[model samples]
Each structure stands twice: as structure tokens, then as C-alpha cells.
Target: MAFTVKINNLSKELTLFLNWLFSIDIQANMPGKSRTFRCKTVKFWSIWPLPPKVEEVHDVVYLDGIYLARNLCVLICCNDTHVLGWYVCRYEHAKALFNVKTMDQAFIWINELSAWRMTYSDFLREMTVDEFENKCFTHERLLKAESSIWRMIRQQTLFTFLEYIDITVPTTNNRIEGGVNAQLRSMLRAHRGLTLERRLKAVY
Candidate 1:
């Protein structure tokens, strides 16, 4: 059996914070092993002309007898090690960056590159619905507009110029859609006791 920590006046807030950090999952809790948590607690100083001894301070924070366990069934896949797609995207980003001259243009190009990467990352992994809607969707639209401009540039048959630069064909945002489906499944499973705090807590 797993032991539950007591949530009293002093510990109630900390308990809630930890729960938020771990998020939620419905499964059996079995006592595995006990461990201690040690961290440095710090204090702030206002000005430079303060006492040297009191200027910088630190305290030790400790937690004892915490049980930790691993769930064999809750395995998740990671594709970040799959480097070919990312290398291609990076090549394209470098090409775009080289073509742009102004600082503002460079910044926007970088934004699109980052967004493009995020789009692919979400596709390979699972993400929340909000991430799908906000990050992936926004990037897809931007890339579509950019694709048109690139098409016009390529039509000039500047073979030698094109050879020096890399190109990435923009793909559909299907990964973003899949993320939304995963989020929906999470929501449906935890739908019985629907409250604002509970929903937000479960999602975050």
C-alpha cells in the first residue's frame, strides 16, 4: 500500500502545488521505495550597500520518506532522436535566413523556422489541444504563405542560386489535428465531475 502525506495548515498549499506539477492519472498506487528531497532555499537582498555576511543567504529544505514508483504500462514514445526530418528543416531554415537581409525580416524568418519545427515535433509526438490550435495551426498558415513566395522565386529557374539553398515543402497540419484528438480523449475520460478548477487542473 502507498502512504498518503498529511495535508495540514502548513502543508496544504505545498501539497496542492505538487499535485499540479505532477498532473493527473488514474491508476493503482503501490509503495515502491522511500527517498528524501533536499533543495536550497534562498533569500533576497534589496541593495548593494548591505552587510556582507547578510548580503547572500541560503537555507536547506528537506523532505523525508517519500515513496516513488514507476508504472510499466504508462510508456510514452519519443522521436526527437529521429534526426533526418529535423536536418532537412534546418537546411531550409538556413537557406531562408541567408536570403533575408533586414533584422526584422530575419526575426520573422526565425519565428517561422521555430514554428515549423514545433509543427513537426507535435506531429511526431502527442500534444494538447491548445498546443495544436495555437502553435501548430499558426505555423501552418504562415508556412503556406511563404510557400507561395518560394514558388514564385523558384519559377525564375535560378538553378545555381537554388542549388546553394535548401528547400522544405510545407506539409499539412495533420499532426496538430491528432494532438487535438488526444486532448479530447483526455477530456472525455475525466468528464464526470466537471468543474472549472478540476478541468484546468487535469489539462495543465
Candidate 2:
């Protein structure tokens, strides 16, 4: 009977811990320690929360990145309501372009354009008067030829969403931005003492 009671108490404590961990608004109202279990909030935080395994793929998903620090960012994937997955990295990259054949072609084209721009700039620096006159007409053309990798990636992202037009996917990821990301920022601000690892765990 005593052992059964202990088990029940432990289970209750575990439930409370999980509730505190995930609850943003509740945390603001709770005390630093669990009154019933006599456990400090730090003890609960010490146990790292694992990200839930996501096997089902949503037809329409939203992707966004939120910066935690100067060099650190978290990329989030979500459907209409729930966050499916997240990745922590130093820099943001276009996930839509990964493992596609067109990615290589786009990079190659951008690289060739960049190389040509560099060559043109160097030529202009050492050109003779007659050479300068010949190339002067091309200066405006060179300016117009400038390419941006981000611009290309943005176009691809838009095209992917356009392909899913028959479905009810939102044109913007405002749900994730206003709901999940906003809550996360608020929670982080409340618990500013968390280390990088713990901060990520909190996010997970």
C-alpha cells in the first residue's frame, strides 16, 4: 500500500512537471518550487525534454526561422496549428531547395554570373582609354545582370505554395508567426537565465 501511494505521488509530480514545462502563461503564475512535491523549478528544467517524433507528413506546411542569438536561429515547421519539427542552426538556409535537381543548376548559374561580374570589374580598373570607351556602354548592362541567390530561393518557395493552390493552405505563415513564435519569445524572455541547450530544450 505504501509503495502504491509513492508511485501515484511520483506520477502526479511528473504530470505537473510536464504541464509547467509546456505552459507559457501558467509559468508566470506558478511559484519557483512545487508546493506539494517540494521540488525546485530547476530540478524539472534539468530533465531535458525530447522533441516528439513526427511521422505523418502534412500536405501544406509553413516554415519560419526565429533568432535566439546573434548567430543562432531555430527553423520551425508547422501545419495549421501544431509545430511538426524544428532545427537549430547558426544560419538559415532554403530548405525547399534541398535534394532537388534545379538547386545545382541555380547555384551554377549564380556562380557564373558572379564570376563574370568580378572579371568585368577587374577589366574596368586596368582598361586603356579606347578600351574604357568600348566597355562604357556595358556598365549599365552589368548592373542589370546582378543576381541574388535569395531572390531565386524566394521565387521557388512561392512557386511551391502555388502548386498547392487546390488545397486550403494559407498564403502567409501568420499563424506560426503570431501564435507559436510569439509565445516562444515571451517564454524565453520570462526565463532568460536558461543556457543555450536548455533554451533549445524549452523550445522543443
Find the candidate with the highest TM-score and give its number.
Answer: 2
Off by over 4 Å in 1: 1-166
Q: What is the alpha-carbon lDDT of model 1 when measured against the actual structure? A: 0.35
lDDT per residue for candidate 1 within 1-204, as digits (tens), equals 999997554354344334423444321221221111111101101112221222322221111110111211111111222111100011112246456645466557656856875777655444335734653443564457556655644574322233433544223323322443354345535454435334333332
Q: Per-candidate RMSD vs. true structure?
A: 20.0, 13.4
Q: Who wins the lDDT comparison?
A: 2
Candidates' C-alpha lDDT: 0.35, 0.65
lDDT (tens digit, per residue) of candidate 2 on 1-204: 355433345555667666665665444456553354335344665675455799896787878888887888988888887888887767775653333345455566556656765777865445334544563433443344344444655567524543554677565779889889988888888678668878877776
Clashing pairs in model 1?
none
User: Against the hidden reference, what TM-scores do the models get?
Assistant: 0.20, 0.53
In candidate 2, what residue range of length 10 has the lowest lDDT sum? 136-145
